[model samples]
Target: MARAAKKDAGNDTISLIPDDPNVPRPRLHKLIIKNFRAIGAQPVVIELDEIVVLVGPNNSGKSSILRAYDLVMKQGSNEGKLETEDFPNGIVDNAALPEIELQTIVFDKAPGDRWIGATEDGEMLIREKWTWSSPNVQPKRQGFDVQKGDWDDQVPWGAPAVANSRRPLPHRIEAFASPEIQASEISNLLMGILKDRIKTHKTGGEGQEKSDYDQLMESISNLQKNVVESTKAEIDVVEGQVSALLEKVFPKYRIKLDAKPEVDPEKTYTPFKASADLLMGPQDGYFSKVSQQGSGARRTLLWTALKFVSETKTPNDGGTRPHVLLLDEPEICLHPSAIREARTVLYDLPKTKTWQVMITTHSPVFIDLSRDNTTIVRVERAQDNAIHGVTLYRPNRSKLDDDDKRNLKALNVCDPYVNEFFFGGRVVIVEGDTEYTAFSLVRDLFPEKYRDLHVIRARGKGIIATIAKILNQFSSSYAILHDSDQPETDKGDKNPAWGMNSGILSAVNSASDSSAIRLVACIENFEAAMFEKAATSDKPYNALVRIRDDEALQTKVCGLLDALLDSNLPVPDGCIRWNALEQLEAGVAK
Candidate 1:
């Protein structure tokens, strides 16, 4: 596993180094795209992790990032050719040519030709440029010149040579979102596994097994030669006729039919050359081809095949290629239950140390903030009509202790909607159900003004700090509103609830330096501050009923809503620092 760190020169490039030298597996660290479709002239830098989940609305460039990665890493798929539409805004001029830079951490023990230019931390920077002054052009690799401090665009390497030099280069498997699954697709996946097995059949095997495998390959080649020789007499008849017809036309040239057999058994005897039909039926009944079933069944079959590959594929054991799985919307066509299972499979695929997973999803079920080595990036089209990606959550910046981690996990399990804020713009974190219900009603009153506003119910005071720390880690500006719990209990008391008030305020201050943070609290509790007395039970119900009947309370709640929703509105009796709460208590206690 690797960790992200800033360069000493303070550039925007993110450098990755392994946390432990013993765990040396090649992995992608970061990707930068410029002048690509959906992404404009301004570069969009995405920091990769073991499991990266990209979430956003439709056409927000999430799929573009995944496709760009596939285009660069995987060879012979369109052969790195770029169409006019691939350029930004469908313009294909020199300035609009697309370019992508990939930064990868390659361990010395990994099985590949280690390229020359590598940083001291063992990170390799490879640049891919589409040097097209016209349409349908090919891309080239630009190696970085450490001495010149620039890219050597004229690196004398073709795409195939570059791909071959890095033998067993991370085997990339793409499962882009699709409604229908063809039998050919399944055959291709199975053939990939079979091809890999055949390639490594003799590795670490007994001497007799290795000799048998070599003899098998040799026998296949001999059979091909024998077949060609057996067919030569029959082919000579056609060749004679063709040559005679050619002599009648020109009398100077002759034609011959040359039949050459493919000698490679891996190519001649793979699953791709045959028809693959998947049948599904009850144990005691007749089976039908899966193509006859609905899209859901086919999609489920595809997912099962992917899970199979992830589990049964060769592990990255210093002699095999590592795998990169670029999946787009694994949740598509899946039932809610199946989607959850898919999420787990995609997440756990990388744990085997053989595969790394990247996916674009619209489901919050795929986003988990508590997991290490997981990154959640929110991709969207900005107001300027360019795509922008913001990493809304990463584990390293959480600053969470063990207690916080336990509390965060408990919150994640208990609250099904805790991850919804990643899809919203401006967020408001409330302590419990009371403020969530009341402020939600207020937000509904003015929907357009607060279109992007999302109010998250933290469910308890203790979990507010954890949630706030996560929001702050991604530099998300948000407002925190909770009960001070002060007049009911002394602020200096040892009560944990009392302590969380200051704890929550401290989180706000830590985030306020980089992003806007506002804190507004009820003096004693929501019921007391709004209805003039604390509720014995049903606090949220009481607050909701009172606000509906009482006009004055609505006006006051609207004032608080302004502070929580609007960036310009100042919070009432807000404290930036934790200890400063006491001085502001007098103002809030009114």
Candidate 2:
């Protein structure tokens, strides 16, 4: 109160204000790969979101994309050496050189801003090219060039000397998998954590008063000094004799020993070089080496450790730089629940640490279709066997109707099998669980037809149209089977199946090409139709259950279905309409 009374009439006080909120941070914007591994001469441009998920069949170039990106952004060591097998088709003769280009956008001033010169469009371009000595020889990196240009600019330019300069960014890019989890890796991680903590405390001035760290450092110094002194004393005892012998052999020459421990406290004491062992086991039990741990346990530990390291800030003199994690098949060897947990961690990484995450996965457990920030890139080979670029699909909640959005959310929450749709080549959508079960049982009968086909349960006639729309968006070839549920003329308008039929018809009519889509309406419900054709009994569920659980029953059911399918007569009692079976067969034949 007394100080307030002394306020001057003409105030000259200045207020502490923060920087402009409009300032944008630097981030990796896109990646372009050309003629690299499975990728063809055409450049595949992939826009990077906070979290990028690459999903495709095996050998479809998903891993190649990750490896290419890793090659560009990797630092500290050159561990990725291009081999002969890395060439497309394992052939390099008369082939185009492999190229990888990275696009980075900066919105604000950064310490390493000088390392990257902005293009006319205000973006940085880093390009790497590789060439092989011959078709049979392995490919070697030709040059890494950085320039200022638009990301999509196809013009070629001469290499710049700046490409050989050191990277100014303070970040680390690492790949995590079962094979990368080793004792040395664990030790290095521990050392990084310890160094970060120590730096944090020292910077905050909280540990200055505590002499424990200082005392430890002093002890280390003394130990190093003692070792050097003892070694030098031992060397001195032999120095005279050795020098005399050397002088006698050569009068103008003399030899002397210099025994000194060339020790760098910081590097020599790092966890990687230091003799540090981690023993882990149950309490009150004899401990075992970490190497002896089970695969699952080791995986869990590695995951936990990575999660911690990724979230923690690495102490640096320069400002913190952005980090991007490249994970290839993180679901490998993990339990189903653990895979889901991993998904959660990946989803949270951007928010928690502002880090970018890229994952390649074949498991549905790793995908959450409802997430907004996540971008799913579908990588597939072209019909001509040429490497095709990835198709990026970002789930926009605004584009979906409220009802459709709710349905999608429910599917994510209740149906774990929904992800299989993304991985399958063709989809067979049926109404309810009974149809799904029956189709699954008969699927093996047509191995060629159903080799890459995935059967999904729509649970109701109302949802069949929704499923069809979703599948269509994925560019998936699909067949829909449902009951006609025809009612009396007076009540036909009120039948639920009628509405479903209309919806299905509407979707089909709106399609640009409907050749890939097939629809069949059963004359009656699934059970009624199956019971009418039952060879042994009228109980449809029992018959289907037997077919699913008993190999003998499955053989019998297959035989009956095949016989009925082969017959020319109208099979009104068949589980599936005769017309539907004919249409399915015709579609498969095509």
Candidate 3:
């Protein structure tokens, strides 16, 4: 067993031994929340991916999950004491207190370890409960006993003494959106870097700076002692008065005042106690505080500080605690160019081997579909009137080929609105720009009825299957509108359009049946069916002019839009559903 050793027999100070070399480090795997703010009594379990992205509407409980993790970890200072608002619906008389459970996994473990009821593959569960019944009782932390299938309160795994012994909790790093730059947030990041560097110097790090740093710390320590000695007379006078008052109650107790306040140099200073003010100036040399700058500059400063910490805190040989970053809407207050740059940095951060990232974003630029082991969770309030998080996209279910990945990356770069469907309720996937232009305009005609409708332009038929598969994974009720390029004669042939049609149907059928799917195809092409003409290169411009001037074409477009959005409406004429494709091919249905 590892033990701490005292320096002397009479000394009260003891030296701490390094963490156990044999025990495996724990990584946060999942979080289960119950009776917390915005979430009801039923537990909501969310699995943490290497790079998980949470995208949803406002006030949909996306931020609550991030706050819940910080509440349990207590790494960030933003979370204060729990109040009535912390409970579900702010009613706590007959309700259970809020509970947050952490599920962790440790790889390459030995036979038996300090984790009380860990599995053979090294899975462990720990929980924290808030106190609401009494004011004096603090929060409770416990572990699960797998053998008995119950929770055990005797376990002190996350307490201060046992946390850093053999089971070290991950260091939670957080950056949230604010109306303005918070000096304390930036100060904490900067001071953490400064302290880490000072620690490196004190511990036999290379260079003459180490000696200089030690000398500086010694001088400061001596100054702290001198100040206490000079105030000894004042302290004695106060102690005499305090002891006289105490003697009235005990009548036999004697009191002595010993004034000794010192600084350890490493343990004394922190960002919470002190602030680091950043000043910016132009070439003319008129410097001003960062707080006086614009919102853009302050946001940029926070981004830069976060990047600096991530760069400096590189992975060591299991000596440092693991880090999990919770970033809320990084694209806020950033210019378009800056948003792209921030997205690249955040997407690449998890590759550092010691960091895991989770972000809640409203911008599609922060989401990358090509990344591996990435999960996109869509948070929304369900019919049950409780918040729910559904996995909208994951790498395992996607099965994206190289070509599909290239197409997705190109779309992510070229089109800013390609991912808007992830935030919509009923989506319509169209093949070309003409359909997208016409359908979007028609949907706008009935703004209130089709307010939740999202029209996504695939730009090509090959990418339709990819979008369909993703929608299927989301379990969304959506429609796909495509062009039937050939007649029934070409169905048996090796036409690429036929192959693409089969692929789209196959993807849609994998997860949903006909009730949840709406497949519409325009015979020959969109222009041929709507205007009785051959396909033209300027179809998008023609669509605009025709929809604006021609009433007949506008009526036809509205019918198709209604068929796609409302399941009760039958498939409109000149448009073919999946089952009627054969009839249209034989010139019978149209």
Candidate 4:
């Protein structure tokens, strides 16, 4: 509102005006990692263009990635339980058992930074994956490619090929946000806004009961004081070092000055009004005095710094590009408008030739605001205690795209399609329409999997097609059996017109369809109940049929269906017999 003040530019540190308006940029190609906690040894190749979102349940460690840059700044300091290190200083119970191995790349050679640029353009969000199986972490696996045709109709100029780069004070930036994004430079920016809005005084009772202003104001004051007081000497040392560095670049500005300790909260309690010579925008009027700003404005003003920084930072002198931007729970404590506003900041920042911003958010509202190329990494834990025991998910963006192809597509795909037609969802693949319909109808037959998945019908317009569609969306193991009808080929003709090149069969064999989608066959009955002997588990389903009362057919079938198929939550007993999966779904009693 204050004419969208250029976020970090007007701040104290970066006052050095640029000689040229446009700075050169570098390419951000890939990221390499290992023993980096739950990730163990994994190389996460990030495309320079796409804006990624890291997600997962608690303990899945999605936020850790953002924290790593800080550790890197510290040169691998001893830290205990990650969450603890989240507080002040190194963690108390911290250990140095296994240090994390991490590296990143920014691809500059390719031209287009716009992921969906014209086909003539060949650059987009590409994910290169690697793994560290042992404690001896190192990068060794190939990453899966995440690309788009780079269509001309979508991105005309052909996206700019962003180069690899890092901030001038990468250490300071890391140090600022290290241990937690909540503590980074962005946090400093927020704190500045907060100090500007704090109600320092008010009419009150004679005692410490406080006049509403006392408690909150005191907390902010105390924390600010602590930071300044505790770090006085350290601040001096840093300031001295910074002064030395400045000499290397700008030797002038002969004005030697002292850095005001950040804890000098009292100084900022009063607002800095615009001088008569400098005019104020409409919103700027709100900040004429710290007392004038409403408390509600804190969320908006504090969060807007991120948006400002994005628009302010000029590209570097043709150097390597910054590969990733790790943002953790940015929506916390923000109002609906502020959250919405924050989301806009995230999406818009990467719309330019900037680095990929990978954020971890628990807000469904935020999730609803993303595009197709935004990767969603969902984390899960294991039975044993392992540092890098986290599962990563790169949601299939096709489902959302397909949904946008038409209207009926919405009814078939589900509610998620209503908002997201590209990224962030799950797919349930089965055999045919009957199976699709049956499963769709009985989908809730298994409540555990129903609420958690975005089931879509595909290919044969049946269960098998749906199965293929699901495979396209998710990366974990999934399979589907087709009612092959034992159709024998017209062997007599060398080139039989059997049309093996079409329909569900072709999709099953297409080069693009990786092993993520497995195809099996069942002849005779539509139900896959014959290939039991040679098939896999036919767990809980049999148990469902074995356990359900005569009235709850839906429950029984749904239970068996979920247990036989796959699910997010644990399958209930009536759902199916976990071990009997192969027999029921694949049509095999054995």
Candidate 5:
């Protein structure tokens, strides 16, 4: 998981808007799950955010929150205790009953009827209670505000309890579901302002002919008054100039208000399908092709549409301009070159009031290549299944001292990269960094083998200790890859170490497969081969290798590095092979 390369970690750009005493807070900023699946007999509560990301194993119930949202929207309330149809795939079979209740805690924000449209000055607060029985969850008015004060001190706009008692929050799932649907797909997720663009260049429609006729008549009446009072020559000359100016201003849309170009009667115009990507794309037709495509293509197309819409200005709605937005799993489908360009597109849009968006992925390319890091998320499923949850770690204010900054002067010396991935999520410890990199990378090297790969490297205390920590947390699986060896220092044991890694994976995911994806050797020295082969030549290691060399081979690796350094080769990859041991020998003589 790549981190946010933040310039200002602690500050939020949106200052808290003041509130009125009458207005109540809006809804849903926190979640409280009770006896919900693995979340023990004791309950677990997590706060929600504007950009909340749910992440965990396949069965850890990370998707439970979304399921809960869908249910409340569908059935309408959280009353009593829930039954089968209340959740995804029915009855929470994988999780226990009675112990399977998911209570959602809601926080309050703005106020008023914030549905279709709100007057610039209106504000409303909403709170929802969800149990197993009611489809009409109460939409009580906590309070209202005039245009100004902190949320901490606000009063209700009206007698909210009495008013809400009179009118129900319209059982319209459309209010909430629409935003979800819109956000889920790229083409559907137009800038909030795009909905108003059609109004700007509006064409008359059926059933509005009488109104149109009246408007046309009014315009003609105004024109007639001008024509009768003014000199015909002056009017004609002015009209001609206006037509020419319009043509110049909008060369692509040169439809004249006063004149038409002469044309041949028998001329044929070719049907358009080629030459421009825009013609076959979202601009002219339903972007149905994108949805029909696989996930990767769809993701890329989503990003493409966002980039296209953002570059072209959409009309303003009310006082705000509509922003077209698209988000693709930036690290996934597209080529690296495309990802870099797409990141630029994403960065440029959000600064405008017209757009706001976020993208996600697990690739390292983005971290190294990005110009900025305002948004990024790391997701991990815990090793044990007992209490499943996801951690959303951002580069916000942390109490890092000067020593911390000094320790991270180089990427090589920094703490393990996956430290944050396991931050709020479950921890699955492995042998070392090599195993971490190897487990994830090797699958790609041999795609025919692994299905879904998740790996983390625990720095010390061996795989057994890591597994032990995990076993105490969740029901996880493990996969240990080690070699056959005699008891060198009484620190080696095959079964215990193997169980450790496998146990952690199984425990956290709560998966049935509790065994390790273990690999053991009969009589070979695995570390020896690994060290000599995957030669990661840091300065000290390479320096030793140079001393071991007979001056000739030492000159070779040095020459290669120097030459590449001149051409801007990355340092992380300057040296990664076996000459270092040879250099160590020459150093011994010195």
Candidate 6:
């Protein structure tokens, strides 16, 4: 079994070398797209990270980046030829021919520079262009242009040898979309693995030991022959009936059925292929069709199967081609738990450096900020409105402190709700779990107003500033809520600015815009203030007891906040925090 490899220092490419110490994997370093759909005339250059993730809003060209890669690499056979609508704004008449250029670094053990003009960094450029004489043409003429050396001073478009060498790179591009895995796809994947294993077994050398292998192969051949024969016999019966019906109906014309075997028996007999169509349900029963299962189940099954096949080694003879896995929206139609499981698989997939995985997704469930090697590309419509521009966000050590880095790394892994901020329009950063709970209850009061606002726990007062700074980097508007911890002394009561000078509060205030980042400090702590306010009620003891009980806390908090908003009584001292919340909401509205 082939194990996943660790990243070599400074190397962004996967290790192409199998078990051999000398072989090097070909790595995709950069991609350049020009005049492609949703991409303008100015070339969009993207530097490939080890695990590249593209994320953005709808129609912002996130999928277009993946398609650009597919168009150039031809990952699958049915990528559909470049049509007129594929051009930007569906206008190809006045536009220049669309182009996709790829730069890769290949390390070959057997020496003779396979690259035309190899760069000092061992990078080579392969450019694919689509040209059509007229818009009416069904398929455009595709051309390959390869260049090596510096970006400037490159060769012309027709270099066959370099182009041929780069063809293997495309074979390495394997793209999988969500929930739509065809039967043929599963069959092909399984067949490829079985073929590689059989080849490996045969090359292990000769002896009586080979007899067992030969016998197994013979059994497989016999079974395949029987199946083919039975299939043909059935086809013959159907064809005969059709022909008889046609003769009776037309008298002059007869139907001829040419039912040749769709799959070659020699290539079709494999353990993997035999089990490709089989599906095990949640219970003991077997599902006849994968399509019958829920979308989440189907996606999980396909992803698991692909992961299994990817871990298998290629034939020693180098017959199997390497590929980069391109996945689009793996989180689609998945349950939360299933999405998390998918995230683990995706995160670990590219770690072995066996194959690179590039995914485009809108779901934050798929985003893991901890992994240093994962490259996040935010794609959005450019301000100029000509095309979409992509911004790369890689984990860097320079900008963040160790503690802040650890918090970010632990976010999705330990804190499941932090990712909600990514999907939200505004954020409310509260100091602890209690604050989070209270605010969440409060948010339910105005569902429409708070629909786009996400509440996140900062875990500690010290971390609130850090969380605010991090959110700022993503251009998020956030407000902070924390306990002032003010003492109940005469001097403290006299000073209205008691908690305003705290280090955490000062850090937050200085780091964020005064309007966008509002800070609310409870005079004595959230629970204390809530209790104080409930004390003013007619049944003070009962209200405090209701707030104390876990079951009643949520409802009581809602009732308390509602009462405060209605101005049914004098505002309680604890309810002063609501003013800060109002200001925050007003700023967010602006």
Clashes of 6: 5
Each prediction's RMSD over C-alphas, in Å, is: 8.5, 13.0, 7.3, 17.4, 21.3, 14.1
Candidate 6 C-alpha lDDT tens digits along 158-194: 2323333333333121234333354435545556566
- How good is model 4 by TM-score? 0.43
Q: Write the per-residue lDDT of candidate 1 for residues 300-325, one digit (tens) a residue.
A: 87778777776874622233445667
Candidate 6: stretches off by over 4 Å = 1-24, 41-46, 75-80, 108-181, 195-297, 309-321, 382-389, 397-410, 441-451, 461-473, 476-590
Candidate 2, residues 293-365, lDDT tens digits: the string is: 8766666766776677667654332223345667778786687777767777778766633367788888877
Candidate 3 matches the true fold with a TM-score of: 0.76
Q: Local error of candidate 2 at 173, Å?
A: 10
C-alpha TM-scores of all predictions: 0.77, 0.61, 0.76, 0.43, 0.37, 0.59
Those runs of model 3 whose alpha carbons end farther than 4 Å from true positions after fitting are 1-25, 75-80, 108-137, 156-158, 161-181, 190-279, 283-289, 309-316, 487-494, 512-515, 579-590
Which should have the higher TM-score, number 3 or number 5? Answer: 3
Instruction: Give the 10-residue window scoring lowest on summed lDDT in candidate 1.
Output: 8-17
- Per-residue lDDT over 396-469 for candidate 3, one digit per residue giving the tens place of the 0 to 100 score: 77878888888888778877668887775788999989889888777776688778888889989988988887
Off by over 4 Å in 5: 1-54, 66-89, 92-127, 132-184, 191-193, 198-297, 308-332, 336-350, 353-387, 390-392, 400-590
Scored by TM-score, the top model is: 1
True-structure lDDT of candidate 3: 0.67
The 0-to-1 C-alpha lDDT of every candidate, in the order given, reads: 0.67, 0.57, 0.67, 0.40, 0.35, 0.55
Candidate 5: give its CA RMSD in angstroms: 21.3
